[model samples]
Target: MVLWENLQAVLAQRGVAGFGVTTAAPFPEMAARLEDAVASGRSAGLPFTFGDPATAADIRVSFPWASRLVVVATSYLPAAGSPGAGVPGRARIARFATRDHYRPLREALEAVAGLLTAAGHRAAVVSDDHRLVDRAAAVRAGVGWPGKSTLVLVPGAGPWVLLGSVVTDAELPVSEPMRRTCGTCVACLPACPTGAIVAPGMLDARRCLAAVLQSAGWIPLELRAAVGDRLYGCDDCLEACPPGDRALATATAEQGSVDVSRLLAMDDATLRAEFPHFYVPRNSGRWLRRNCLVVLGNTGGAAAIGVLAGYAGHRDSMLRGHAVWALGRIDDPRGRGVLTRVAASDPDAAVVAEAATALAGTLTG
Candidate 1:
C-alpha cells in the first residue's frame, strides 16, 4: 500500500493522465473472448489477435511472479492551438498516430516499474505490445471503463488517453473498478466510416479502413471509396464518443494528415521514416503509397490526375493496381487515358484486372 501511494504521487507529478492498480490475476474471461474471436475468424489483419486464451489473458505467463499490475494513462490529445495535419490535397491521420503517444505512456509505466524494482520487487512494463490486453488491465485497475468504441474512457479524458501498464510482484491492493458505463449511447457504432464497428464495443478489423490500409494484399474493391482521404488510422468512432469530451476538443483528427502528392513524391525510405510510429507491413512504404493513391482518387480530383498517372506506371503491381483505382476515382480523361495504357501495356495480371474494373466503371456510369 505504501509502495502504491508512492507510485501514485510519482505518476501525478510526471503528468500522467491517471493511474490505478489491479491484481495480476489471470483474466480468463478476456482469454475466452479472444479465443472465440480467433476461432470464429473475427480476428483478422491484427496479428496479435492469434494464439490461445492463456497468451492473451494471464499476466503470469509473462511475469511469473507478478502479484499486482499498475495501469497508467496518458492523454494523446493534441495541445491547444497546435497546427493540424489536415490539408485540402492531403490524407487524414488518426489522432493516436499523429505522433508517438506510446513512448510517453511507456516512459510513465517504466517509472512505476522502476519504483517497484528499487524496492526489491520484480517489475516489467508493456504498452501496445501484445503481451497484455491493456484495456482489460485498465478496466480491472479502475482507471476507466470500456467505452462503446472499445477504447478505455477515462473520467476526464474520454477515449483520448493512451494506456500502458507495469506488472510487479508486489502484492498491492486491487483497484476499485469504475461504476460507469456508456448506458444507451451508441454514437461510435454508426460513426465508423467503413462500418468496422459492427456493434457496440465490437470491431471487425477486416472492414476497418485503418487495418486494411496496414494490410499486405489488395485493397478490397468494396472498401476503397470508404478509405476516403485517410492516409493512416481512422478516428471516426473515437471522435463520435461523447464521454469526457471536454478534453477531447483539443485533439484535431486532421493534425496528422500528410500531403498525398508530397508523400507520394518521396522515395520509399523517406516515406517510412516520415512516420516512424506507423504500422506498415514489412516496414515498407509501398503499402503507404497504395493508401495515398486511394486518397488521391477519393479527394485529389483534377490536381491529382497527374500524380495518379505517374503511379499508373509504377513498378510495383500493387501500387499500380491501387493507382488504377485512384485514376478511376478521379475519373479525369487524362487519368482514364493512363488507365487505357495500363490496361493494354501493364505486365501484371492483377494490375490489368484493376484497370479493367476501373475502366468498366467509367463505361457503366
Candidate 2:
C-alpha cells in the first residue's frame, strides 16, 4: 500500500488527471460485447481495440507476465475547444485531437511503469489502439463509467480525457470500480449528427463521423453532407454531452477553424508535418486531402472552387473522386464547368461516375 500511495503521488506530479488499478484479469464481458459489435458490422474497419476483442479483453493473454492493470486518464485539452462551431471556408478539428493527448498519456503510464520497475517488477505500458480493451479496464479500475458516447467519463472531467494503461506483475491493490451510470440521460444519443449513437451506450462506428474521418477511404456519400466542414474528427456528440459542458473551453475562431482551401493546397509532406497527430492511413497525404475535399464539399462553397478544381484533376484517383464530389455539392457556375469536364474525361471510372452524378444533380437541382 505504501508503494501504491507513492505511485499515486508520482502520477499526480506528472499531471495525470485520474487513475485507478484493477487485477490484470481478462475482460470477459468486453470480449462478448466486442464479438457482438464485430458480428453486426458495427466494428468494421475500426483500428482500435475492436480489432481482436478476445486478446484485447484479456490483457494477460497478450502479456502473460502481467498481474495488475493500472488505468489512467489524462485531460488532453483543459476543455472541449470550440464545439460544433463551423466557419465557412474552414473546418473543425475535434478538441480531443486539436493536439495529441495520447503521447502524454503514454508518458504518464511510462512514469508509473518506471516506479514498478524500480520495485523490481516488470511493467508494460499499453495504450491507445494497442489492442487493450482500455475502457473496460478503466471501468473495472474505477476510473469512470462508460459514457453514452462510448467514452470513459470521469466525474467532473466528463469524457474529455484520454485513456491509457500500465500492465505489471506487481501486487498493487485495485481501486473499487465505479457503479455509476448515465442514469436515463440520453442527451448524447440524439446529439450525433449522423445518428452514430444507436442507443444510450451503443455506437455504430460505421456511421460515426469521427470514426469515418480516421478511416482510410473516401468519406461515405450518405454522411458527407452531415460532415459540415469537419476536416478531421467530429465532436458533435461529445460537445453535446452535458457532463463535458462545464469543462468546455471557448476557442477563438482562429483557433478552431482550419482553412479548407489552404489545407487542400498543402502538399502531402506538409499535411503530415502539420498534423502528426492525425491517423492518416498509410501516412499518405491523399487520405488527408481526401478528407479536405469532403470538408470543402460541405462548406467550402464558391471560395473552395479553385482548390477543388485543382484536386479534381489530381494524380490520385481517390482524391480526384472526392474533389468531384465537392464540385458537385457546390452550386457555383465555375464548379459546374469543372464537373462537366471531369464527367466527360476523368480516367478513373469512380471519379467519372461521381462527376456524372454531380452533373445530373446540377441539372435537376
Candidate 3:
C-alpha cells in the first residue's frame, strides 16, 4: 500500500491526470468481446486488432510474472484558443494527433517503471502499443468508463485523455472499477458520419472513416462523401457527447491545420517533417496526398479542379484513382475533361475503373 501511494504521488507530480492499480488477471470478458468483434468482421482492415485475442486480453501473457497493472490517463486537450478553428481550405486533424502526447505519456510511464524497478520489482511500460487492451485496463483501474464511441471517458475530462500502463510483478492494492455509466445517452450513435458506431459500445471499423483514412489502398467511393473535409481521423461521435463538450472547453485548440493545397504541394520529406505523427508508409507522401485529394474534392472551389487534374495521370494508381474521383466531385468541365482522358488512357485497371465511375456520375448529373 505504501508503494502504491508513492507511485500515485509520482504520477501526480508527473501531471498524469488520473491513475489506478488493478490485478493483472486475464480479462475473459474482454477477450470474448474482441473475439466477437473480429468474428463478426466488425474490425476488418485494422491489422492491429487482428492479433491473438488471448494475449491481448491478458497482461500476464506479455509479462508472465506481472501481478499488478498501473493504468494512467493524461489529458491531451490543448488550451481553448490555440489555433485549429476557422481555417478554410484546411483539413481537420483529430485532437489526439494534433500534438505528440504519446511521447510525454511514455516518458511518464517509464518513470513509473523505474520507480518500481528501484523497489526491486520488474516493470514494463506499454502505451499505444498492443501488449494489452488499454481501455480495459483503464476501466478495471477505475480511471474511467468506456463510452459508446469505444473511448475511455474520464469524468469531467471525457474522452480527451490518452491512456497508458505499467505492468509490474509487485502486488499493489487494487482500485475499484468506476460506477459511472452513459445511462440513456445515445448521442454518439447517430453522430457518427459513416455509421461506424453500429450500436452502443460496438464499433464497425470497416465503416469508420477514421480507420479508412489510415488504411492502405483506395478509399471506398461510398465512404468518401462522409469523410468530407477530414484529412486524417474523425471526431464527430466524440464531439457530440455531452462530456466531450466540457473536455473541449478546457482543451486548447491545436495550433494549425494542414492546408489542403499546401499538403498536396508538399514532397515526401516536407510532409514527414510537417506532420511526423501521420502514419506515412515507407516515408511515402502518397497517403497524405490521397487524403488531401479527398478534402479538396469535398471543400475546394474551381481552382482545386486544376490541382486535382494534374494527378489524373499520376504514376501511382491509388492517387490517380482518387484524383479521378476528386475531378468528378469538383464537377467542372475541365475536371470532366481530365477524367475523360484518364478513362480512355490510364494504364491501371483500378484507375480506369474509378475514372469511368467518376465520368459516369458527371455525365449523368
Candidate 4:
C-alpha cells in the first residue's frame, strides 16, 4: 500500500479538493454496454472508431498487482452571484461545462499518474465520453450518492461538482460510498417541468431537459414547450431541492449572474473566444444555436422575434430549421415570408419541410 500522507499531499498541491479510492472489479454490464456503444458510434457520425471496450481488460486483470481506483472530485461550483448565476432566461451554463473541467481534471490526474509511473506502477485516467456516466461511477466509488434529481450529490460539495477517476494498479486505502441522504425529499421530482425524474434515482434521459438540449438532431415539438427558456441543461429540478436551492443561491450570490441575452447574441467567433474551455464549441456551435432558438421561441415576445427572423435564412440547416420552428411559436406575421422563402429554396429536405410546416401553421393560426 502507498503512503496515505504522500498521496494526500500530492492531491493538495494539485488543488483537488476531495478524492477517494475504490477497488476495480469486473463490471460485466459496463463491458457489454461498451460493445454496443462502439457499434452505435460507428454509424452515429462519430469521427473515429471506438473499440468494443473503452477500458482495457488489462486494468482489471492486473488488479491483483494494482492497488486502487483513485477517484477525485473538484469543486467547480461558482461563488454566489458569479457570472454563471441565474435562471434560464439569463442562460446559466453549468459550472462544470463553462470552465471545461476535462482538461484541468486530466492534468491533475496525470500528476497522480506520474507519481505511480515513477514508482513503476501502471495507471490510467478516464474522462467524460457519451457512454460512461462519470457521476454514477463516482457514486459507486463512494464519493457521493445519486440524489432525487439524479445528480450525484457529494456530502460537502452537494451536486455542484464534477468527477474524474484514476484507475491504477497500485492499491490505496478506499472510502465507502455515501449513503442516500435524500431523506424522503421529493422537491426535485415536482420541480422538473417535464417530469423527467419520474421517480427518485431514475432519470429518463430522453425527457431530461439537459439531455434533450445537448442532443443532436431534431427535438420533438411536444417537449419544446416544457423546455422553457433553457438554452442548455435544465436546472429547475436542482434549483427546487432544498440543498440545491441553498447551494446554488450561495454559489451564485458570490458570483455575478449570467446573462442569457449576451449568450444569445454571441457569434461563433465570440463564443469560441468567450467560452474557450466549453463543450458547446466542440459541437461546432450548431446545437448551441438550436438551443438558443428554442429559448427564443419560448420567450414569444417582440424582442426575440427579430432575432429568430434573422436566423430564418441562416446557411446551417439545423439553425434554419430551428429558426423556422421558433417563428411558428412566436406567430410573427413577418416569419411567414421568411418561412415561405426558406420552404422554397433550402436545399436540405428536412429544413424545407420544417419551414413549409411553420409557414402553414402561421397562415392557419
The segments of candidate 1 whose C-alpha lies over 4 angstroms from its true place after superposition are: 80-87, 252-254
Query: Which lDDT values do the candidates have, in the order given?
Result: 0.83, 0.82, 0.82, 0.67
Q: Please tell me which model should have the higher lDDT, number 1 or number 4.
A: 1
**TM-score between model 1 and native:** 0.95
Question: Where does candidate 4 stray beyond 4 Å?
Answer: 12-17, 29-66, 79-90, 102-104, 129-133, 253-270, 280-282, 336-365
Model 3: worst 10 consecutive residues (lDDT sum)? 79-88
lDDT ranking of the models:
1, 2, 3, 4
Worst 10 contiguous positions by lDDT, candidate 4:
42-51
Would you list the clashing residue pairs of candidate 2?
A: none
lDDT of 3 at 143: 94
lDDT of 2 by residue, 210-299 (tens): 888888877778888898878778777777777777665533333556776777778789978988878867887777778888888887
Looking at model 2, residue 129 earns an lDDT score of 55
Determine which window of 10 residues in candidate 2 has minimal summed lDDT.
247-256
Error of 1 at 52 (Å): 4.8
What digit string (tens of lDDT, one per residue) describes model 1 on residues 1-365? 78878998999998887788999888888988787777766677367735546866888887788888889999877642123433557888777787787878888888888899999999988777677898999998999998878889998788888888888888887879899999999898888888877777787788988788888888899999898878888777777888756776665433565688999999999999999989988999988898898888888888988888888888788888999988887657887788889999899998999999899887676
Clashes of 3: 5
Per candidate, the number of residue pairs that clash is 1, 0, 5, 23
Model 3 accuracy (lDDT, Cα)? 0.82
Candidate 3 ranges with C-alpha deviation above 4 Å: 79-88, 252-256, 280-283
